[model samples]
Target: MSSPRGGTARTAPPGRNPAPQPAPPPGPNPEPDSTGLVPYPAEVAARYRAAGLWRGHSLPAELMAAARAHGDRTALITPEVRWSYAELSATAERFAAGLLARTRLRPGDAVMFQMGNVAETVVTYLGCLLAGIRPVCTLPQHGTREVAVLARHLGARGLVLQADFGRGQLPEQARALLAEGVIEEAVVVRGEVFGKAVGYGELLRAGTGNDPGTLPYHSRPPEGVAVFQLSGGTTGLPKIAPRQHEEYAYNGALWGRTLGWGEGTVVLYPLPIMHNAGVSLALQPALLSGAALVLAPSADIGTLLDLIERTRPQVLPLVPPALAIRLLEEPRSHRTDLSCLTDFIVGGQKLPLEVAERLRDELGIAVRQKFGMAEGMFLLTPSGAGEWIRHHTVGTPLSPLDEIRILRPGTEDEVPDGEIGELCVRGPYTIRGYYRAERHNASAFTLDGFYRTGDLARRHRLGGAPCYSIDGRIKDVINRGVEKIHADEVEDLVMRHPDVAHVALVAMPDPVLGERACAYLVMEPGRAPLTVATLGAFLLGEGLARYKLPERVESVDALPLSNVGKVSKKELRQDIETKLAAETV
Candidate 1:
């Protein structure tokens, strides 16, 4: 898929390449995850499944239930639109019917959604869910290379995108997919389209024509994929983690209850709605509780504060650490009426203790640290927990059925409590395997089905509440804000430069972004050294997204090595931090 935005298809470096496998051919009345479903021993699967944990209900069903419970209550809010529960449910039903009337897409055919946090995205997302089309959630920042590759990998039959996101060429990206015959249906939202692609308004209008009373809608069987959640891998291209309907619905319901959320709760959602955090943690929970979900225009402090002042949201979920800091320090914050703020859910990485303390003591907003992964399990501090427990640790799992083990690094042996170790998890919501990735699944999960989440964590107790605190990460990935940049992916791109002999990319300390990528290079014999500008230009020319570029470059004679002769990223990481500390001083 060649991009009209320029540059040929990006050749993902070794560590950035996904396995060369695709899902099974499209079929009628298929189980969603079974396309690449990793089988548990048949006997074991049957016995476990007999527990009947999966609820296999459609995504719309969850919202419809909420609508029935509170039809007149506000369900979704944006700068331009407000949808009550009953209205939102009716819209989704119409949108689902329109999708069926407009596209030839069948059940189990993957449909990718690349949209912003808008009302239309929600409508189309619910439409896909009720239509039995598995929607693959993708961030809008993903360009042609990322989108095309993911579309191909998942065998997506159609794509739904917005034209007015104010970013990269959305239409160009959609055209590339259609030009390559990668997708059969094109559902463009919030824009005019004259081509074979269907317009968003047209879809809704067509749906209105379809008799909602006659439309097919029912509960899906348990244990089928509901949505494909993208994984921010430590050493490879994004992997698809298929979430089952039953377990996923359970995750939303339980977390909502655990956080003491129900009808009348108003939440300010700032993260990307398509992401796992936005969908599972924020959107779904809010809908299940019959709460009003008011999406932030952007992550900028001005926008968030403006929304807070106008909407008076009772709940706020923020991922960027900088936002919390800015909100507390910004001059406007002093004037803004923040009394309506009840709790702030900080999810990406650990928020510093001092920052959480400031939010509590200064702003009077309780900080609930949340640690979750796309693979399934979510650990969030409850609303009314003790100060230390709420601020310091991510409380116990949402589901009592969830299992966690703090294992010694690289081994399955359990570590003693209070000792930091690799976190391995297995539960109803967590995925057993990645889609169609046999080898990756083999490495990512244990034989008994525990996902080795590269996060370093330790079990602890605070005021009698059993909880876990994240210590650090063993994975070679950089979390700049909530965005993860894999070290290997960046290193591979740097290696392609002629001026570099050996290259290593490491995360550097940052006050705002949390971490920015810095590249260390050993100059090739007789070759010129490189600068951040030149390297950044090269990476951009090579189709790397601007956000993934290395912010700093350093000349090095050699990279430090581990005892096993492999490059020790740990040493490099320490060196960068030490250097940054000295520079600051």
Candidate 2:
């Protein structure tokens, strides 16, 4: 299970010395009041700094250093553009200066990013960091409704978007938001810009004669929030997780070193660049390690295989289970020369053992399993793990300092090693609490500070180290490939339909996506039954992301209830599973 470069799956590479932990910096820790962010306690922050886990440098600083070290080397590649390290750094600085000069945004302002996997996405994100502006990483698939909710929640002043993406409705949405004063500025990329919206090229050109060094690039401390990553929450629209500069950088560096990435390493990333995995697992790591990052605009299997054949990348860091299935189904995948690939990490959902075996036996690819969250803990299958440990388990924590606890579902009691329980974690990289979410934080984090990750997992001994395997989830969220569909959110929306009386959304088995949302509806007695297409169109019109719509609809007389009269989702899940099995038979 060694990496193609022969590096073992240890925390650090073989000969590299662990970074020396330093004492706490000589200053009072910044209070979280200003930004509504929840900062780590003073003692805990001190401990992390002492343990060398929380380095004292901003993300922009790291990129600047990389630029100096790997100046002329290619940093990013897209279908339409290629940028060198020096070029990226310069353009980012220019964009940052332009943002300050042209827009109403200040150093500490928040900007919403809803762009695709293009070169501008990278440049814009880096620019925000360089200017000490926090970027809210929203998906391009999001519409006006989703963006409005998130933007209003964060009090974001600016929106950076791709104008031509997906039916080209973003410009109209941006215009509407601007008219309503929901956002003050809109920076449109790659399309016709109308109204008060400023073109991205215009913004970039605005900084032409300005000196980047004169700007307040280092105004904010490294301990301040650098980005806001969205959580897949069950109760509502996603919660915001504020990532600090120091800890977030460490997350990327640790992952890059773990996978043996270096100057010559080229990693292909086709996932949403604004997602947590895209930033931590691919972008940050590649930049910090001075490796080349190839961005794929589409996740189509044929497109990906073609990219691999042309780029000959050494790593494909974040492939979801659905994409893996599609690759295996594509004839070109088997014919392509994937010999240059050394690591193929599958995550977002559990990789079935059968699929894992097929990948290894037929394609000669050793698949590594990853389990991570926006809140911060990461687990990956070790390179030296046994077959059972590699395929069945999701491996151990990425950091030696990561503390894990398996607690009973409703209580703080620890479960036995082999039994499944809720996964609770508290570490340097993991946040103490989500931003401005005090009500939810009360139950999300324990009094002692562990974040209750709503995932159910079990621990096992592998090679004398404790490895973990995910069994199920305690949250009412369905993992549809990389997109998490919260049942409660969809149920609330469905209840708004005129003919719907009662509705329950549950996860149904899917061969490719792993899980798809199935809606069990008890429609109004005299009304005609609703179809999946009608319900999907209704939900889409309601501004919900297309991915969150129910794929299958069923009309039930009534929803099964537990003893306490609560809707029994467990029973609904069992019912759907039984019906699906019968249909297959």
Candidate 3:
């Protein structure tokens, strides 16, 4: 599906309302501008420089500067507490010092983190940055098995974890792994018991002071690794992408400016900060722009609504599922004053047209679709609430330094606009290669060096500016709303089933979950009979996380084959859709 076109600024000369018409081609002046380049306001340019993001992907200097500039200003606000910039910086400094003292971690060491949308996640993140430690963020949804597998793959020197953020309980898992000689030490954030583990409270106490203002500072390269954002799990293995601090800073500041943010801008961060959208769109942008960063620790609709009411944030960057169902829940309307809201940027998955329409018509807020990745490239332009654009398009591309190209899925040839292909990106901020994954990295880039996004997209223009609309993923990944599952992993597990001959996992559209896995299996002849429930049980027994297990299974005598003799997952997905439709009817 494609999103609607963006609106353009028109000139009526003296004192007349310009007649509504099709927007002119993309440029600073659709009508006529001599410069030929869209000149950003001087203020926007100044803010970029002042925010310390004008360079490449560097953020430590800017983060330090912003925290110092807004020393007394509230940097982070949650239902439970608010942390001033000074307080956050100080806690981070102390936490950094404590980590340094307690572990062998040093500058450039990769530290794995799994925490929720709480204040500690931020503190620990900043702490890692300040200590010159690179952080690899993991989703809180991962169970012990996933964490163990990913952590082992990362070979992380340190781990920052909450006691029991979700089903995982990473700290306990880390401790158990340590006992099993899998890992060395684990750092606990909050209330989970672990012997010989460092508690976050104690780390906070080790900081500069209650004032946190007097802490010493050390400088690092702007191009240094700030955070290692993991690739979306919709693929086989999650790759760790090293985000530079400067580019990250620039992204945040630009996002702020795009929203007309300043000191008064209050942003609600419901998505976990570990995500690129969260860190770049919400926390980093708000901090850099001196806006209030409101925190919604839980995605619960009631809790989210309550926080929104109390905070009255101007921007809410959240995934679409939470907004859709909650906005339509009976009582249907919240009495809260959401008047301050200027934009509601939705990403992670495409926002359903019904949900967007209701949100715009009922909630009276602009529902802007954004396409972004942990790798730093993004698309954030205002889209018309038209059916074509809303349902078919994503939005226009952002980041002047970034270029997106659509290529034929199998071949490395560029494809015509509107034709679905593998999305490849080349940009100052986009990663050249994933950390330590040489073979995959080699395959991930073109010979000329554009990072292959592995996502299926169609190129388009919105009001003359280059934009893209996401159709589906070229990779074998499933987006289950909040969670992502690697199709290959599941297929591998399914192959282990004695009764299963072969299997393919594909995402089926779900109203609430965004997408759910539907497995099409070719059972071994004469093997113990296999059914949907039995396959699911076998998968669960194989230790696949609940969220990753197939929600529906279809037994097929043989998998549909493509012209190339490969199993046509597309046909399987279509079959699943047909079955689902038949059941619903």
Q: lDDT per model, in order? A: 0.73, 0.81, 0.66
Q: Please write out the lDDT profile of model 3 over residues 1-585, one tens digit for every residue.
A: 111121122222232222223321222211112311112233433444453336633476677788889888878898777988888877788888777666767776777777888888888888877777877777665656666666676666666778867664576677777776555657888666588878887776665443333222255655455777777452456576766666667667766766667776778876667766678878887887788898887666677678777888878765553344355552525565667777777766545455566666777766677777776677764534455665456665554445566888666687777777788765445665675566676677765456688788887755555567876565677989988787756776787776765667898989998899988876666776566678878889999888887888777776764321235777888887888899999
lDDT digits (tens) for residues 411-442 of candidate 2: 77778778878888766788888888777787
Q: How many backbone clashes does candidate 3 have?
A: 20
Q: Which model, 1 or 3, shows the larger TM-score?
A: 1
The local distance difference test score of model 1 is 0.73
TM-score versus the correct structure, for each prediction: 0.75, 0.79, 0.71
For every candidate in turn, the CA RMSD to the true structure comes to: 14.3, 11.5, 13.2
Q: Model 3: residues >4 Å from true position, as ranges?
A: 1-58, 209-217, 234-238, 330-335, 383-392, 475-585
The top-ranked prediction according to lDDT is 2
The full ranking of all candidates by TM-score, starting with the best, is 2, 1, 3
Candidate 1 Cα misplacement greater than 4 A, ranges: 1-34, 39-56, 213-219, 233-237, 462-465, 476-585
Worst 10 residues of 3 by lDDT: 29-38
Count clashing residue pairs per candidate. 1, 0, 20
